[model samples]
Target: MKIKVLIADDHQLFREGIANLLFSAENIEVIAQAQDGADAIEKAKHFKPDVILLDIAMPVMNGIEATKKLK
Candidate 1:
């Protein structure tokens, strides 16, 4: 089965670049993308991705805070 993934980053170009790279992988899928930590949490709850690629610094909320809330 393909591994579902969610990527969260404030940088649009970076996020899209990562998503594209993951999408090219046969065993992985880019399921969703988020602009910040809060958005990542919301998407995670809804999508329940197998993995999350998150940035440490972001607007609204940061990766560390988001990880705490998710856990």
Candidate 2:
């Protein structure tokens, strides 16, 4: 099965770049993208991706806090 992935970052270019890179991998799938930590949480709950890539610094909530909430 393909590994589902969720990417969360405040930078549009960075987020899209990562997503593009992940998409090149046959075993990985980019399921969703979030602009901030809060959006990441919401998408996580909905998509339930196998992996979540977060930016340490973001608006609304930081990666550390989002990781805690997700846990």
Candidate 3:
């Protein structure tokens, strides 16, 4: 099965860039993208992605805090 992934970053260009790069990998599937940690949390919950690429610094909530909550 393909690996599902979710990317979270405050910068749209960076997020898109990463998504595009991952898309080039046939085994990786980009499931969703979030603009902030909180949004990432919600999307992660709903999407239940196999992997999450989170930025350490983000608005609304940071990656560290989001990781704690997600765990």
Q: Which candidate is the best by TM-score?
A: 2
Candidate 2 structure, TM-score to reference:
0.98
lDDT string for model 1 (1-71, tens) is: 99999999999999999998887899999999999999999999999999999999999999999999999
**Clash-forming residue pairs, model 2:** none
**Alpha carbon lDDT of residue 38, candidate 1?**
99
Clashes of 3: 0
Total clashing residue pairs per candidate?
0, 0, 0
> How far in Å is the alpha carbon of 4 misplaced in model 3?
0.4
Q: Write the per-residue lDDT of candidate 2 for residues 1-71, one digit (tens) a residue.
A: 99999999999999999999988999999999999999999999999999999999999999999999999
Instruction: Determine which window of 10 residues in candidate 2 has minimal summed lDDT.
Output: 15-24
TM-score of each: 0.97, 0.98, 0.98
Stretches of candidate 1 off by over 4 Å are none
Residue 12, model 3: Cα distance from true site in angstroms: 0.2
1-71 per-residue lDDT for model 3 (tens digits): 99999999999999999999999999999999999999999999999999999999999999999999999
**Two-way TM-score contest, 2 vs 3, winner:** 2
lDDT of each: 0.97, 0.97, 0.97
A best-first ranking of the candidates according to their lDDT comes to 2, 3, 1
Model 1 error, position 13 (Å): 0.5
